[model samples]
Target chain A: MTASSSLDGVLAPVLTPFGPDLSVDEARFIRLARTLMDQGLGLAPFGTTSEGNSLSVDEKIGLMDALAAAGLDMARMMPGTGCCALSDSVRLSAHAVTLGCGGVLMLPPFYYKNPSEDGLFAAFAETIERVGDARLRVFLYHFPQQSQVPITLSLIERLLKAYPGIVAGAKDSSGDFANMEAMCTHFPGFKVFAGTERLILSVMRAGGAGCISANANIHGAAMLDLVRRWQEPDAAKHQTALEGFRSVMEGLPLIAALKAVTARRTGEPEWRRVRPPLVQFPVEREEELMERLKGIGVLG
Target chain B: MTASSSLDGVLAPVLTPFGPDLSVDEARFIRLARTLMDQGLGLAPFGTTSEGNSLSVDEKIGLMDALAAAGLDMARMMPGTGCCALSDSVRLSAHAVTLGCGGVLMLPPFYYKNPSEDGLFAAFAETIERVGDARLRVFLYHFPQQSQVPITLSLIERLLKAYPGIVAGAKDSSGDFANMEAMCTHFPGFKVFAGTERLILSVMRAGGAGCISANANIHGAAMLDLVRRWQEPDAAKHQTALEGFRSVMEGLPLIAALKAVTARRTGEPEWRRVRPPLVQFPVEREEELMERLKGIGVLG
Candidate 1:
């Protein structure tokens, strides 16, 4: 149950930037990863916030080199490698492992809904077996709201029993804090993560790893600050302040809103552009969003 | 708007054949497709039944050439080309178009669930625009049960109005006959389809073009026979026979059941192998399945 892992920290699923042609802006991606690392945050690139599902396998692979070139250690980066296809997952994970990534956050094959646990287990097992690199580590992504293929506790238990070390942990984004708490308690050594910073204090108290949040793209330093000092008495107050962002994000298109704020912060309009099936945050709301962020001291 | 399309008939979302190693067996796939076509079925080679999501984009692209090489006219095929990534979807659709395929059946981006109509519309519009092919025709695949993103009427109307000749039709796999009937009634000359043969008679009666069914893999001739003769007096009797397959498929793992029967019929055990996330049909259930099929006269 040693917490001697590079992955056990506050990580941001880096928001992807796209050029005018809606292509992956590798330079921007690397720059963001570097900036987050400089702020003492680990990086979980290519998770939902990055619109990982919106990028092709080649595009995802193409952006990895820039991270290395930017002097960002692969050891602190956990790129999301899950695709609907087993072969695609294997290739992406194998590539990540080769580059010394801390771990690959994996989503179940989400296209098929309500698959049996045995079927899901087989999917995870096959990917792990095919990747074949002993260096490979996996975090089962449990965002039931987005990915209807839920990674239930029994499924986790099965994976843990089968491949103890390789099945490292999970990211619970069901917005169900109880599930996150249960995961942290049940899997003693596993690195469980909350999808938002609001649960960081509670998750940490439960012996969980840390937060891998969408908001961390904009508030990396703040989240990392709390992560490092959550044992203090004022941790709840810190969490409450952080919880303000979620209220701002509520009822708005979340990923789009995050991108909008990133665009404002970085002075790069391209940060606001999302891939198709994800419209940009409305221009009309930007003023209100910024005002609210400033109200909570989330923006200066 | 003339019903002269090769795609306007019974098309099997052709069952994929996997080898012992679990890689797509191109030769077996071509052989099965050829057999189905020979039995008077059009081909939708990469739909849900085909384990389309279980395949990588390259793997899907690699299989297309074999369909062309088998003396199978691509104009008689409408391959499923949707992916979670817009680029991947565009690439797949464009590839299908270039090969002279009649149409591409497209699932909306299935990864991010509950995307807005605007976002979904933008995804479709973007894929169509980026593909930039005039000859391309698309069948908006509405399989909400698996994809979780339902293609509502308003979304369909938007797509249709925007792309007159291009947004040719839809395949309603909701198993809700009312929706299919409504599509047929609401949009004149739009080709609506049922996802199974049991609904074929009803769909065609309501002006649906035909069916793109999974059972067509095992029972192509029987369904196609019913499709051709549904206008005849004894059509109900023919449909009753076809409906028997659904009863057997009920409460069983569908794709696996289809594959097991295909294996038995072809005398190729390899047909039973599915990619990971979908285990082979339970060996124990094979006998009962076979017995039931026999009872229904689905087996010789």
Candidate 2:
């Protein structure tokens, strides 16, 4: 179950679960993986939704090992292995390959702001070179808005040319349709995944692989349907559903809110506990979010 | 000793030395710390120069503990503990306080770009609340240039007003003297440290807590002399020497070049291994840097 085939369908940045004490709830993570997969999602855990940045390197590896041991097919998994430090990134990405993950989604070394496009190329190239695993599939994770480090088009071209097999595609979380369009057109055969659900159909139209969205945790079936109906005559309905979900998450802490909903749904109230500095949804915010989720009629 | 007095003085953002295998060279770190302190420097380790961001949470804590155990006085130490994660930041800041560190220089939650000022306030406020350590002297580390998240004047005011005792001061690494001046004037009691040595004279005139500089690693004595004799009629000579040393570092990767110089002076060539993504000084750059250091006549 190695991820040898193209990642050409719906994949969700799976939500991470925590116990009431905010420890990684391994049982819940496995259950979430199984549930999302059953709901037709290819998995990308330890992503933004998973608070990938929040987890320590050891914790990330532990979660991945847990998933693999639970027999989740690696081909369907693309865990985020990016970190500010290259050593951590390499270790995570290499371990993912060893576990047969279809690909490791690598974010640019993000701590250094406005790093030259050349620096980014060198970082990626060196990591791929150092990993020295021909089986390694490198998918660039572009979330410039959050990272404050843009992965320019030129760097992507340089990487693809240098390591054709290793640099497979990108997860474009830039939130700019023009950038998404540019990525799709500029790089032939490089699979581009939309960062958000709002642009799923548009991204699909622009030749994107699929969306790796945070909202897909709760709206997995609908998101999958949205991708499926991209070419359908009634495709506008899918787009509207995505917009509704987007509206709920806008101007709020999307990750925090998403975890709250998932916790309630999965009968694990403790899963609602977010790590510090990212407080749990206040009572009013939680109620409003729950009401909105019910209105979307996906609570079932 | 607790830092009851102003943390004024020429504080060097000391560089960390790693063995060829990239493990922490505790001997080099201690030697460097002792040499700088002997030359009248206040110590600020695990900062941008020390590749603090590259270190894991445990590594940072260990470095702090090692320095303390090496007889580095807490009142003279200002460790860089800023990170993207809140819990990590809290742990670092809290531990520093417990160890009686002068203050923890904190970078904001940097992964998320352009976070609202309110969000920034929440982050700082939450950290102080969670640490709950009165011994803590929090210094807002405003390195907008690197963090990509600027701490605005309004946010600073809000933080100061809300947590008067917790928000002690700030280190403005923005390099804009006017901003530094504004901070000094606006927050009269606030200890403001200029990030670079270039503004030492101006910042000093503006009631600023002397410079917290990267170049101070090699220029400590010269910078201290200038600070000590700012009122001396012959202080211009000291200022010129300081500026010359600054220009040398400005020509190279400031952190790496400082480590190289420190290693050379201390006869520890192995002290120059920066962590991954930040490669070592090329031989040519090293030679060029050495020539500048020699030309400045600051080194034998």
Candidate 3:
């Protein structure tokens, strides 16, 4: 099957757990990923919500190795393999493709802001040429808020013109539903992933693929169910519940709040430990956040 | 002597030369760096102008090794060692220290935009701790226009309070002379390096250390001269000339223009090659730019 066809549902831009020493807690990571997969969601490990940019190349490579060793089906995984360094991106993308990953989510070379379209195109072309893999499927990450580098439609057109099958699709984390809808409309077979599940129903109805979400780390089962039954008569109610839960989560720092919710579910405080440049969710607000989650029926 | 003491005067964020294959040409890089040193400037290799962020850690380490093997004095080279990944930053910083480099210029962990001050502190603190070397000196790089992650005065104060000796100084590249002046004014012993030669006189008068400049790639001897003769009667005229030169350079992509100028000066056309995400200077504009440079008395 084509990469786009295989990537047609909810996927967790998975939460990466760390030990007290801030090293990737491989066992915990594996367990959490397995649980998400069991909930019938795919994995986008090392995306922004996963604190992917905060991870060293060597650390990420080791984590991928661990995931493979655990016999997790690599075909269900589409890791975020982009970096500011072209060499690093090429290395990670090639490695991911080698491991039978469904695809790789690639951020633009983000360190330079407002780069020329020629430069941006050159960066992608350079990496693709260097990787030289026909099997590779790249999903462009357009998160202008975080990366400060907007992946414009013209650039997508240029990329698709250059590499038809290899260009694959996009993940729009910019929160511009119109842009997502435009991608779904513009590229007939393009896989368009909304960055969150809050827009999954509309996104799916737009002939978009599905969501690759931050909340999926906490609410994977519900979101996966929504993706499956999105056309059902009760789908509107389901989408509303997801939206309500997301609104409360949005009030807190995203990754931290997602981890806090996971910690609550599993009784494992260490799950709340984020790496440097990302502080832990505040203990002071934990009770209040949990109470609100319960008020919204997001918690049992 | 301390790491700070040895890092006075102008330092070129030296240009990186790429081959036809776009791999770094170590020989050309070393030759260019050696020439800059001979012109009485220190080196800030692997900096923004050098496409440091576009380079992998392995590539940087290899460049460092080549420099050492060529007998370039490590104590005169304060390479840019910071990365979005704390682990990569720590590794590069420690490596620079172990090589006996004078100081390491560091950008804050920049991937996540508007990170909490607490998180910024943790990223810096975590890297400093992991490197675990007292000899490691850090020169904070404040270029908000590029990184979009400002290194605020409050944040600097927190870092200095935590690690006084290790957090040596800063390079203010925000193009805000008032901020540079304020830094030099507030921090009694702190070394504040202006990001460009245009601010050198004012900054030096305000007790800033000399500049760490991209223009220094093409105009090292001139900037170094300005730093030495700022107290001379004719210094104001000298400063105006430098500013005029800078104005023209700013009109183009700074690094690409710098490289184009270098290519002209050295008669080595390959000097115009820039890595991806940074295209070469437009060939069509070369004559006009050169004529403008000549008009300003910056070119022969």
Candidate 4:
């Protein structure tokens, strides 16, 4: 399940489970992974929604090991391996590749502002060169809205021409359809996954691989179905439903709302405890979100 | 020395020295500290100009320990100890207090966006609570122009009221003289250090302690002279030279230019190496910067 091979399906940025004491609840995390796998979705843990940046390298590696022990197929997963430091990103990305994970979603070392494209090329090339593993396939994560650094089409061209095999594809979370269209048009065989569910149909229409969305944690099956039937007779109906769910998530601090929905569904109260600076939703926001979820038929 | 006992002075955000391999150059770094001390300047390392967020905790702690080992007076220096992670901030800041450093210049946990005032309060208060040291005197760092997170006036008041002694002053890098004046007026006794040299006179006029500027590396004596004669009839003459130097550094990457100057001055050409993603200035830019410096009489 290397990225050079195909990942022609939906993938969820899985919800991280915290136990009562707020430690990584590995078993529950594994359980969630299994649930997504059972629903025919691929896994992407340790992404932005997975609180990837907050976890130390050791914690991230431990979680991956636990997932492997749980017998989840690594080839179907694309763990996020990005950090402010190049070496940290390299360690996580290279290790994930060695573990037989499908591909690494690498975010640019993002602390600096307006890093030149040449700087970006150097960072990416150095990581690939240092990892020095032919088995590794790197998928650039282009969430410029958060990273403050974007993966431009020109950069993609430069990387592709330099090392065609090492740089496989990208995730365009810029929420710009035109940018996604450009990637899909220019890099024909490269796998382009939408960063959100809202763009699934457009991405698919433009010949993208399926979406790797955060909301997949709650509406996994529906979004998966939306991707599946987007070319079907009743495509519009499912697309509208998917868009509605995306709207709710967009309206709030998305990660918190996703955790809230997960908590409500699983009755896992500890799921609601986010790290400080990202507080749990206050009672009113939580209640409103719960009602929205129930109204959308996501929760009964 | 506790911040409350003696916190008013001009502190230089000391430049970090990098070896040819871009690893921490301890000897040069310590030498820079000694040089600043000899010239009647207090020391602060690991500010934005020092590329603190770009450093590993080990690098930060190692540098601080080296400074202490060199028998430099910690009472005259405030090493930056803030970071995106609360735990990391605590470890570095607490250790600074334990080592008897003057005070910790603490930046807000900045990776997240628009953190609530309560969250900011918790992040600050919790660090103090965890360190739980009576000797800790925190100098809040407000550099919104860089950190993308501003410390508002109300928040400052709240933190001051909560921990009267633990929170001492602030370093305002907003580059807004009006804001500095407001801060000085609001917090009567709080020592405010202008983040930029351009604002030094206005800041001093508004009762600011002094500046913690990156340009101070090149114009340390002239800037210090301005600080000294802030009330003298000929003070403006020295400040004009400082301004001319500042304009050149502003036109280039100040940190890189400063390093290049140090490298050439100390005969450590290898110190010109910057970490990846921040390559050394192109030869033309370097040449131009050198010419600019020579014209201003800082270089020959």
The lDDT for every candidate, in the order shown, is: 0.88, 0.79, 0.89, 0.80
Evaluate every candidate with DockQ and list the scores: 0.84, 0.36, 0.87, 0.44
Per-residue alpha-carbon lDDT of model 3 for A1-300, expressed as tens digits?
A: 155467778889888889887888999999999999988889999999999999999989988988899998888888999899888999999999889888999999999888999999999998898999998999999999999999999999999989889989999999999999999998888899999888889898998888998988878788888888988999999999998988888867889988987898899999999987888888888888889888987766
User: What's model 4's lDDT at A35?
Assistant: 90
Count steric clashes of candidate 1. Answer: 0
Docking class of 1: high
**Which clashing pairs does model 1 show?**
none
Off by over 4 Å in 1: A1-4, B2-4
lDDT of 2 by residue, B1-300 (tens): 123454678888888878665667777788888888888788888788778887777777888888889887878888988777666787888899899887888888777666667668888887788789887887888888888888888988998888776677888999899988988899877888888877777887788778888888877777777676677787666666677677666646666677777767777778677765566666567666777778768786
lDDT of 3 by residue, B1-300 (tens): 144577889999999998888888999999999999999899999899999999999999989888889998888889999899888898899889888898999998898888999999998899899998999888999999999989989898898889988888999998899999888877777889999888999998999889999989877788889899989999988899898888888868988988888889889999999887889999888888989888887767
Question: Model 1 over residues A122-161: C-alpha lDDT tens digits?
Answer: 9999999999877788999999888887999999999998
Model 2: residue B30 alpha-carbon error in angstroms = 3.4
Q: Order of all candidates by lDDT, from best down to worst?
A: 3, 1, 4, 2
Q: What lDDT score is found at residue A164 in candidate 1?
A: 77
For residues B162-254, could you state the per-residue lDDT of candidate 4 as single tens digits?
888788888998888898999899987787888888877878888888888877665666667787789988777777777877877776766
lDDT of 3: 0.89
Locate the minimum summed-lDDT window of 10 residues in model 4 chain A: A1-10
TM-score, predicted candidate 3 vs. hidden true structure: 0.98
Query: Looking at candidate 3, what is the lDDT of residue B116?
Result: 93
Per-residue lDDT, model 3, residue A77, is 84
TM-score of each: 0.98, 0.85, 0.98, 0.92
lDDT per residue for candidate 2 within A219-271, as digits (tens), equals 87887887878999889887987798788788887777887887778777776
